[model samples]
Target: MLNKFLDEVCSHIRCKMAHNDIRAELTAHIEEMQSAGKPIDEAIAAMGDCAEIGAKLDKQHKPLIEWPLIGLTAVIVIIGGIMAFTNDYVMNHSGSDFMRFLLFAVLGITAAAFFMFFNYTKLRDFTWIIYGAVWVIFIGSLIMGTRGNVSYVFLNWIFIAIPLLVAFAGFMDKLRGKGMNGLIISTLLALVSLIPAVLTARRAVIFLLVPFFIMLLAAVYKRHFGVNIKSQKAFLYSGLALTGLLVILSVIRNPYRFARMTDFITNVPEGNAWLISALRDAISSANWIGGADIVYSYAPSVAVPNLMADFALANVIITFGWLAGIVLVAAIIALIVRMFMITRKVKHDFGYYISLAACVMLSMQFVISVLMNLGMFPFMGVSLPFVSHGGTGYAANMVLVGLILSVWRRNNIIGKVPRENKNIQPLVEYADGKNNI
Candidate 1:
């Protein structure tokens, strides 16, 4: 009985060894045959039964892992949280609990809509229609809008209209699985839309100039580094020409912008002494960190009431303190860097354009907000993104974020590189063999 058991154990070991050798030899032979230009089935047939080879190859090539969506989800959630927190602060300062809730609710819905819209993958088809609607809203703002000043319009309609139009257009296109032509067109349309705002706002046109010029720079950058080679020269020249005309017109109307330009050039004492003083006072009033809850009030020293809108950064510094101010600025910088990195990784034109536009929007807000607070640039009522205390500004920024998320999602789906399996032979071997034949 002992001898029989030992013999049986030996037989089992030999069988296992034979099976392992067969697998290794079969795998190597398949690679060799493929490299020598044999068809996959024929190569398998030459080695052994077709059924066995098919089963093994099928198991080897089966997808073992799926792409991670969590990172992208986290980014979207973080942006939404930032927006909500800022909106809550603004609403609380205004002493309107209802508005605070409303703002947060709108922001939450907007974030959800963005996630859903980008996930669908048809954002490229409605480029022209979406583009046209952007223009229509701008024009409509001129006709039916209430005036803030000679050149400023209270066309809050645009804030609502632009997002809805983009969503519908993006949704339609995503269903069709097209490229982001709509996104490209929408960006160009945003440029054209700025024209009417400039024309209507007249002397107040500096508001339009700052955003439009920054956007133009973004477009040029996208064309240069983002692989958009179509009619780039025309777009660049047109933007430059429009900016020049606006600069000339601005000089004629509000000599202050030109004066600031001259002051900047001549190194005049355009120092923001009053603004800086107010900022210092505000900072001293609150804790350096975790004091975003404090809302101190201030009346502008007579020389800078118009600077109220422009001096929001100073206000934030005063109310939140220097450390909070620095943190805010650092956050903006980090966001811009993130955008640049995302754009660089995007291989598709639509994704690249969206990321480029977002970077432009955020960068413009950051530079202008800082300059306005520092009193380097003329006051232009432009609110800082994610930090400013305005419903319209916050909502508009959310829409921009949504569109960016859409582009980013599509880019990941189409352009993600697959991980390599060391067990598998190189795909190029089969192709090289065919070429030789």
Candidate 2:
């Protein structure tokens, strides 16, 4: 409900006092001119561009770096590296193994910094191209992966497609406004990646499906494009129930494919229980303080197939003790909560959706990975985001973090904002012989 003058003022100035004072000065001038039959737009336009005024205000209010959040991430990265170092397997088992980890970390940090400083909305122009390319590469990989294990290429596709899909969803204003579009979008987006997961590896579709639900809920709750599912109680509960049932059924039907999913409930061993059992024992061995070194771990090495990547948090407890694991978990949760806070301040719905999607994706990864590692969930091979050591998952996740940082940067600057702020009348009025309108 902002007037043109106020809206224009906000675009340039981040200082609240300057905004209010200048807006107050212009309000009566605008109203009086309108009362005299002068169009409001003309009156507003006569006040001159807010840029010079904003430039004056910019000296008073500059965007500061989010050092606390950055500090937390740096701490987490250092801890992850330290955890990897504690493993005799990573340090002494092979040459260049540790170097590969360092490379991914550096790449991740670089990508994150690039996105944080760049103009995020510029992607709006290229989103369609990015979206089309994602589907093309992914679908092509899915087809090729069917013949043999092309998972490396497929993983690359998944990494590229996910963030780009989030970007694309942010820009789909028309589609968003059309109501059943959430359901349509949910199914389509879920299926796009789900198909690849199912074709290549069954029962891992949770990664694909979780984001659909997350994006849908975020869009609805935030009222992006004003779309609604209607029947909140029925929709939310039913959607969750259906998802749970599907997960249960997916595990039950494919016992051979998964590692003893119903161990707690059914007490029956499945064909693929070996790796799962090893992972579970490794996680469960820790009490308040975890094992000091990987030599003492229940698992032979952190260099084991799933140990470093999939069961990383479990590996952390094994190497650093439960206290460090608790700290790691708390740090991760804090970062996710920070993302929610940032999402609230974003001025654009597109940016909002991107932030929400990033939060959703990261939260989903952590929850699924932790549960799987601890032997409480069925989805296997999920990585613990930045904490895990794989190049692909780690780098892709860092890019998502970059997306979150991009949104946070946008949130910091008050600007040509969304529709809700338009048409708003100024609250503070003042006499200004200053600008001589």
Which prediction has the highest lDDT against the true structure? 2
* Model 1: lDDT of residue 370: 78
After best superposition, candidate 2 residue 39: deviation in angstroms?
14
lDDT (10s digit) by residue, model 2, range 1-437: 22655667667776553465556545766777788897867776776767776677666556546666677677778777776665545435443445666888999899889877776776767766776776676678666655454566555444654655564464454355555655556445555646656665443455556666666666666665354446433565687898789877976788554445555334344445555665555656666675644444334464345567777887777666788888988887887787677777776666777777777777888888777766677645678888776657787777777877776665644344324544654342223432344
How close is every model to the real structure, measured as TM-score? Answer: 0.54, 0.74
Question: Positional deviation of 248 in candidate 1, in angstroms?
Answer: 5.2
Off by over 4 Å in 1: 1-94, 97-102, 105-109, 112-121, 138-192, 202-249, 252-312, 415-437
RMSD of each: 12.9, 6.8
Model 1, 1-437: lDDT tens per residue?
A: 22232233234332232233334344556669888998766665576544554355434333211112223333433433443345246434333423543565467447635653654234456655655665676567556665543133324433533433344334322322122353345455544555654555443234434444454444445443234534544555676797688669967788665665555334444553344444434434555653433343443223234222345456545444566567656666666676666666765544554545555665666688777665566544566655543555556665666656555555533422112323645434633343332
TM-score of 1: 0.54
